[model samples]
Every structure is written in C-alpha cells, then in structure tokens.
Target: MNNKTAIVTGASAGIGKATAIYLHKQGYKVFAGARRIDHMQDLVQQGIEAHALDVTSPESNQAFVDFVLANSNSIDVIVNSAGFSMQGALEDVAPKDAKSQFDVNVFGLMNITQLVLPTMRAQHSGKIVNISSIGGQMYSPLAGWHYASKHALEAVSDTLRMEVKRFGIDVIIIEPSGTKTEWAGIAMKTLLEQTPKDSAYRDIVEAYADGSFDGFSDTPEQIGELIYKAINAPKPKTRYQPSFSAKMMVIAARKLSYKAFDRRLFKQFRAMISK
Candidate 1:
C-alpha cells in the first residue's frame, strides 16, 4: 500500500466511482463518499472506505472529512466529482433550479475544498482535481445554467490554483466530453422537465433530446485514467481536456469570436432540428 490517502466524492456511480476505484488500484488508501451508501458496497469490499455524503450539506461534508482524517494520517488527493448537469433554455428553467445547479457545482465544491485546505496546507502538498466539462469552455442551447456553473468552476479553479501554490497545493481542472454515464440521462430529464410541452422552445429542446451526442462517448474508466494521470504528474497542467473533441471545442472557443461561435452553434442547432 502506498499509505497515501485520497478522498473521492460522488463515488456511488459514474466518473467519481471509477476514479475512486482507479486510485485504489494505484495503491492510494481511498475514502469514497456519496449520498447513496448502498451503491458503495462494492467499494467497501475492495478495501476502500465508503461513507454517506451529500455535498450540499455542510454537516455531511464535515462528517465525511472527519471520517477520513480519523482513519488516515494525511490527505494526499481530493477529486471533487459530485455534480450534475441541468439543461433548459435560460428563460425556461426555474430560477430556484438554476440556483441548485450552482449550489452543487460551485458552492458545494468550495465548501468541501475549504474543509480540506488546512490539512493540505499543513502537509505542504496535495492535489485538487475538479471534474468540469467541455461545456465549461463552450456554450450550447438548453444548457445555459449548467454551462454557467462549469464556467464558474473553471474560473474558481484557476484562481484557487494561484492562491494555493504558496502552500504547495495544486488545483487542476478536467474538462471531459460525453463520458458514458448516468449524467446524460439525468441532463435530458431536466431538459424536458424544465421546458413545458407548449413552450415555444419545445421543438428545439426535443430535437436536442432525441439526438445522440454520445456517438464518441468516452467510458468513465477512461476519464478515471485521465484523473490519475493529472494527480500523478509531477507538474500537471492547470487544465486538461481528456478527449480530442473536448480539446478541439476548447480551442475553437478560444480562437473564434463570440459572434462567430454563436453563428456556428446556431447553425448546428438548425441542422439538428431539420433532421
């Protein structure tokens, strides 16, 4: 055993679960937490510690952190992956729901990070990997709130990276595209739920729902591998786009003018609905 400790949130399923397993295989003492404790039985059987965690709940976050600290001497890594995508036209999505998106993706993540920073600062070494999305770099229809949250996360990660460097803590962002997981289904559900049947944007929203954006979908394991690479690297890049399409989208967003990107995006949306 490496005896190095790692904390993984949202470990009941999807990329978070896969990441916890990968870290375990890499010999880190992994403590995995999620709201669904039953879903983590397999992790426990694999010698990983599993606990119930709701990132939005401060008490739960505190308890999870304490649990890990009581068992391990040091926190070497923390992969904050407990987030979901909410999709709908900005006007159509309920304001409260939009706030919930930010709560989980931005504020909740910061809450957990604040809890771990003291330990990392004292140890003078740690890795903070945030699982963002390609949407963080580019925008799309029916997902304004979700994209905004990711954009916020990206900006926060960048600022935190500079702030924590003095204490030897590295904040890294991972931008993944269409990773095969339950996230897509949940996002689609939100798209439909947020937009009414008689809504003017219904046609375009339905078109987006019917389409398959996962033609080149990556597996959760693949993303887990990328997370491992970032954590293990001596000097990892601040941002990582795990897939070719993600990298291209980020580059396009950076190189193209806002109006140009909008024209291209709308053109694609037009095509999607026409078919």
Candidate 2:
C-alpha cells in the first residue's frame, strides 16, 4: 500500500474518514478530500494530505485532479464516497430534491471518476471504488428518490468496470446496508419536511420517518473496513456487500418474486411504524 497514492472523497467523516486514516496508517500517501477542511485536521496531523473538494462542481473536481497529479505524479486509487440521502416517496419528493440527490450522488461521482481516469490510464493501473448502498439494488419504501440515484449509480459503476478493465483500472462497488451515519438523521428530517401530511404518500412517509428515528442503522466503520479490503486486495471482487443485513436483504430481494418482495417490504414498513 505504501507504494500507492490514494484519493478519498468525503474523507471528512464517516466511512470516508475511516478509510483515509486506515490507508495512511498502512503507509500509503493519502489525500483526503471533503468540503470541510477542519474535519480533516486530525488527518493532516497524522501526515495525510487534505483537500477541499465539492464533487458536484466540475471546476472543483478538475482542480483536485490537477493538484493531486502535480504533487504526486500519479494516483493509484480513487474512492468516491461523497453522497447523502433524501427520503420520501417519489410523488412526495419535489423535482428539485430529486435533482439535488442525483447532482451529488451520481453526477458528482462521475465528474471525479472522469477527471481521474486520464491519469490512471497513463499509469496503466488504478482502482476506482464507488460507495453505493444496499438501497441501490433494492428499493426502500421511504427513500424513493435517493434509491433511484443509487440505482443509477449501480448501472454507472457496472458499465465503468467493464469499460475500464482493459485499461488496467478496476472499478469496484461497495454496497452498504443501513450504516450508522449522520445521513439517516438528516434524511429523516428531510422526509418530514418534504413529505408532509398533505402529500399522497404521507402514510408511508410517516411510517418510514418513524422507523428511521428508531435505532436500526449500522456504523459507518463497517463500510469503511469493507472499502479498505476492496482497495488492498490483490484480486478484488467487482462488488462488495459490507453489512450482513445488507447482504441478506439483497439475497432475499433476488430470491423473492417482485410481488413477494413488495409484500415483505410493506409488511416490514408496517411493523416498523407500529413499533
């Protein structure tokens, strides 16, 4: 790992932060990117380089790539982890809200990946790790728009992996279950505001919001560890399902017919709300 240079987006907190610190400890030249530079002060003190990056902006993405390439000559790994969730039914979600989710989770990730690809290709070797969610594969009754964005990401990552393999650049996807992050709290708040009682999906929104308020999310570090393995493994798998529940959920979704899956999901939603 010491022989490589890694650029981790969203490195200020949660899984991104954990992965950055872990890479640095393993002797890699780690560049941590996030909007809040202060959150990465601790990393700088430990010899990791921190950069302010807003992945939604093309200028910011290009600038980050330029800075890293100029300083290090090459980047061996890139982790795209700058994303958030906004929960609500599709009808309850405003167009602006849905667009905003895609702007950050999908477009922003693509911007950075494209910016870094030229350099990676020049080096003839690189790895791109995209942090998707279990929500990407299976729909969440509450987070419809957010799930749409992740589902789009799944397609993007799949296509990119195939497209870049010939370049010796491996693209890996990390699918995490409900990990414990500030994301859920923020998502729940948005759900309430965006899907008020007057909305058609109010009942489902309320049910999901209540469930999110209760404790059901996993820690971000679990995803971080899975990400670390994806980066360092000699022959990394194309897709990694990090959380145990996340894995099971994907399996269950796949095993069940669409009607059965919908029935089970709705039942789970009712159970959550009753509690």
Candidate 3:
C-alpha cells in the first residue's frame, strides 16, 4: 500500500480518524476528508493530506474529487465513513430528518463512489470500503431511521461489489457493532430530541440509549485495524462484520425467521428497559 493515495471521509474523528492514522502508518499517502478541516490539523501534522469534505453536499464532494484527481492523478482507495445516526421511532422521526439521514448515508456515499470509480476502473485496481453498522443487518427499534439508512447502504455495497469485480475494483462493507466513539453520544442526543417525556416509546428509547452509552463498545482502533487489513489483503472479502457481537448478531439474524428475530429483539429491548 506504500505510495498509494487514499481518500477517507469523516476523517476528523472516530473510526475515520483512526483509519487515516492507520493508513498513514502503513505508508499510504492518505487524504483525510471532513467538514471541519481544523479538526484534522493533527492528521496534517502527522503527514496525512487533509481536505474539507461535506459529503452531504454535492459541490463539496465534487470539489474534493477534483482536488484529488488534480494532485494525485489516481485514487487507490476510497473509504466512505461519513455518516451519523438520527435515532427515534419511525413515526416520531420528522420527514426532513429522515431525508437528511439518507442524504448523507446513502446519497453522499453513492456520489463519492461514482466519482472515484472512473479512476479506479482506469487503473484496473482499487478498493472501496464502506463503513456501515451492524444495525443494517439486525434492526434496533430505538434507531429506526439509522437502521434503515444502513440497510440501504448494505444493499448498495453488495450490489457495487458484484458490478465492480470486472474492473478489478473491490467493494467491501465494514459492519461494526457499538464502537467506543462519539457516535452513541450523538445518537442519544438525537433520541432525546425526538422523544418527548410523555411519548409512548420514551422509556424504551431512554433504556436503549443508556445501554448503548454504557455498553462495552469496541474501540475505534479495532475498526481501523480491520480496515487496514482489508486494504492490504490480496483479496478482500465482500463484507467484514468486525466486532465479536456484530458478527454473531448477523449470524443469528440470518438463521432466525422474521417472527423469531422480532421476538428476540423485543425481549432484549424489554430487558434493557427493566434494568
């Protein structure tokens, strides 16, 4: 991977930040992209090229792509890690909020991938790693919109992998369980914002939010290492369910029917509320 150029969105913090640092350590010329460029100043100090990218904005995405193409001539890897959760019941989430979630998680990811594909195809070798969530495969009632976005991403990534194989470009999905990042804190805040004190789902939402905040979430570095492995591997897999529980949950969801899965999910939610 040495001397290769990589563009990692959401590189200001959390998994994106860790991944950028990890890639840099592995000798890749990393282009760390985030909305808050100042937040990535540390990455610049560490020799990673930092770019301002608001994935939700088409102009920003295009500008970043143009910048990369002008400077590096080719992008070896593109990691779409720019996304967030807007947690709440489906009925409670505002339409605008739901659309915004899809704008970032789905449209933004797709835009960046489309921009990078031409270069990857020309090179005949490149990797695209999309950071999705375990919630994509196994839904949590508390994070309805977030789960829906990830599910969409899961499908898109799967489809892209098959379509891009002929071009020698690989599309890999990274499904992480609850990782120790600001993601849960932000999700909890969104949950409280959408759920009023008297709402029917308030207690359940609070319980799930609290549990997520207190859970043994995996470290961002763990995900970073997994991403690094995917980038370096001779033949990367289609999907990497990283965390222990994440992999197990996907397995369980696959084995169980819909009714069984719903029952188990409800039981788990009820137990959390009871605690």
Candidate 4:
C-alpha cells in the first residue's frame, strides 16, 4: 500500500479540493483545509480530513499543522493552492487591498510553509507544490496587484527551492492558465466593485469581464492530475505548466523583448475586451 500524507490548503473548492481528492485516491492520507469548513464536507465524507484554516492567521496555520501532524506522523507533500486574485486598475486598488492580496497569496503561503518545514526537514524528504498562475510570468491591464503577488510567489518559491533542497525537500511550482472554477467570476466581481463608476478603466474592465474563458480553461481535475504526476516523480521539475497555452505563454514572456511582449500582450487584451 502507498502510505503517504499530503496537506492541501484552499480545499473548499477548485484546484485545492480537486488535488486533495486526487491524492486520496492515490493512497495518500489527505488533510484538507480552508476557511469555508462547510464547503469541505464533501471532502470529509470521502475520508479526507477537512479542517477550518485561516491561512492569514499565524495561529490558524500553526493549529492546522498541529492537527495534521496529530493524525499523521509525516507530511510528505504540501500543496499550497490557497490563493485568490485581486483584480482592478493599479491606481484604483487601495493599498490595504493590495496588502490583503499579498497577505493571502504570498505571506500566507510562506507562513504555512514555514510551519511545515521543521517536520519535512526532520524527515529528510517532502514536496512543496505551489499553485502559481501564468500571470506570474505574464501580465494584463487592471490586474497589477494580482500579477505582482504571483510574481512575488514565483521569486519566493525559487529561493525556497534552493534553501530546502539540502534538506531533501522539493519545491515545485504549478503554473496553470485559465481553469474552470469560480475564481474567474469572483475576480470579475471584485474588479467591477473595486473600480469606480466614472473610472477611466471601466470600459476595459467591463470588456474583460465579458470575454469568455470556455476554450482557454482547463478543468480543476486536470490540474489536480498534473499535480499528482509532478509530486510522484522521483525528480520532479521545478515548474510544471499544466496546459500547452500556458507553457507557450511563459515561453513568449521569457524569450520576447519587453516592448515586443508588451505590445503582443496588449493586442491580445484589446481583442479580448473588444469582443
């Protein structure tokens, strides 16, 4: 029997929930957490341990780590999938809102990882799977803060990878593009609410909202499978792009000149909002 334990944050829905379930199926004891404890009853019913976790709170993070360790002796994997996008024009977003974004996306992840490291380091093996977005590599208008947070995550993850490698912990990043989840709707709603009615960015925000994500998105289950594949590898790559388009976009962002990439990206953004 495959006996491993995995911790998945943001397990109330979307990628985190899917990953928790997938890991369970693969014979790992899954401990899933999110603020929405009610939303995770389904996970509980399926034999995954679900707990209430406020990632932003250090107390909550410590408690979560304690609970998981109480149940399982070792934490073999930790998938940090608890993040949300704060979308709006940079000028329109309040500093507090931007800080909140960083709190959840960057600080929370870091905090949780810190709590788990002692256990992993003692065991001499563990996997840290961070669910980053292609936005970490590329950018769009009106999503400055969101992109910034992801960019920060990318840098932190890179540094952490080096820091933990000596201890036998693998830090892996999953950069998915659009996914079939409530995230898009929530992001759009936040964008509209954050932008003032008479704001100059209204047209762009509205148009961006109208654009459909059907063909461009992957299902949460697909990304979950990718995560499974990545962590299971004896020597996993530092980064995994779950979709072809996401890989291509990351390549473009890395290879193209700044101006060229910006122009190309803006053209696509214009097309998206124009439609």
Give the C-alpha miss distance for residue 137 in model 3, angstroms. 1.3
Q: Give me the runs in candidate 1 sitting further than 4 Å from their true place.
A: none
Instruction: For candidate 1, give the lDDT of residue 225.
Output: 93
Per-candidate alpha-carbon RMSD to the true structure: 1.0, 1.7, 1.2, 1.1
Task: Give a tens-digit lDDT track for model 2, residues 1-275.
Answer: 46789999999988898888887877789989999999999999999989999999999998988888888978999989899677777766778878988999999999999999988998899999998988888885767788889999999999998899999999999988767777777778877887666887777677777765565556676666777788779999988997677789999878989999999987887786676
The digit string of per-residue lDDT tens for model 4 on 1-275 reads 37899999999999999999999999999999999999999998999999999899999999999999999989999999999677888889999999998999999999999999999999999999999998898887888998999999999999999999999999999999989888888888878888899998888888887774557668899999999999989999989998889999899999999999999978987887777
The runs of at least 3 residues in candidate 2 whose Cα sits more than 4 Å from the true structure, single-residue gaps closed, are: 213-217
Query: What local lDDT does model 1 show for residue 223?
Result: 91
Q: Which has the better TM-score: candidate 2, or candidate 4?
A: 4
Task: Tell me the lDDT of candidate 2.
Answer: 0.85
**C-alpha-based local distance difference test score of model 4:** 0.92
Please write out the lDDT profile of model 1 over residues 93-149, one tens digit for every residue.
Answer: 888889998999999999999999999999999999999998898888888999999
Ranked candidates, highest TM-score first: 1, 4, 3, 2
Candidate 3: segments with Cα more than 4 A from true spot: none
- By TM-score, how accurate is candidate 2? 0.94
Error of 2 at 235 (Å): 1.7
lDDT of 3 by residue, 1-275 (tens): 46699999999999999999998898888888999899999999999889999998889999999988888977999989999778888878889999988999999999988999999999999999999988888776867888899999999998998898999999989998878887778778878877888888888888877885666568888899999899779988888987778889999888999999999988988899899
**Please, what is the TM-score per model?**
0.98, 0.94, 0.97, 0.97
